[model samples]
Target: MGVPLLAIVAWSGTGKTTLLQQVIPLLKARGIRTGLIKHTHHQMDIDTPGKDSYLLRKAGADQVIVASHQRWALMCETPDKPLDLADLAARMDYSALDLVLVEGFKDEPVAKIALWRRGVKGEVADLLDEHVIALVSDENLTIDLPLLDINQPVKIADFIENWLR
Candidate 1:
């Protein structure tokens, strides 16, 4: 693998983003340069409507890249077909990252960790899938694979660190 990838899959209100927000900084403290890819089902627009970049894109520009001192963004109009996870991950700067944390895209055939909280969605039955390598949950239940605590980001970070090794 060019860059190690892990998918954080969960139910709608399962605190997937919350746990990751806490976990990412801990990984950074451990000298891990992480990259992220988030999948959203909604109609996406990262640019403002009246901005020059947005205006240009509206004017039928197939692809537009806006650059500045701090950062740059690539805006491409691809409504013909949906994007692929592997293809999107391949587009990243592989040499600069130790891991890529993907949020959502549970249906994709990738190594994943299912996140769950006890009271959030009643139970963990719906979150389990074929690709799950581990289960992160609040309540302990019998399972064959590794089970990590949902409340402990440090433990989760440790688990991820071990996985990276």
Candidate 2:
């Protein structure tokens, strides 16, 4: 199992999901199997009300897992509870994945690439205070870590691979 994981963190509206949408495919093209975990500040539900899975949860099940021939999903009924990222990682099939690209969890200890956009900001936030090993931005930054062009996914992927390896 060669599962290398990292977080792509940014403030709200920084295009974190868009960046992942671009990077994941490039990583896959390079033969990296990617997995992702996105942290949200609000309550979220993958299953809707009155659905079978939702009913199972409403009936007091702590967790409900649904599977098909092609894919599987689990909805855990813990709207107010926080999840442990490490435990979640451990539970995943890392044996088949090459990289786990987590989106958010800005305060987590995981190594991350801070995403920033210039020309449209107030004081830049301190992502470096977290475990940010690199910066991904559209303009020049004064951070101590290596900085990569936000549009260059291949270079970023190489940096990540080298850092993990």
lDDT of each: 0.89, 0.80
Which portions of model 2 miss their true places by more than 4 Å? 119-125
Q: Report per-prediction Cα RMSD to one decimal.
A: 1.5, 2.2
Question: Mind giving the per-residue lDDT tens digits that candidate 1 earns over 68-88?
Answer: 999888877889968799988
* TM of each candidate vs. truth: 0.93, 0.88
TM-score of candidate 2 against the unseen true structure: 0.88
Query: Which candidate wins on TM-score?
Result: 1
Question: Largest lDDT belongs to which candidate?
Answer: 1
lDDT of 2 by residue, 11-86 (tens): 7787889888887787788787888988888767888888898888888999889889998898776658678888
Instruction: Give the lDDT of residue 38 in candidate 1.
Output: 93
Clashing pairs in 1: none
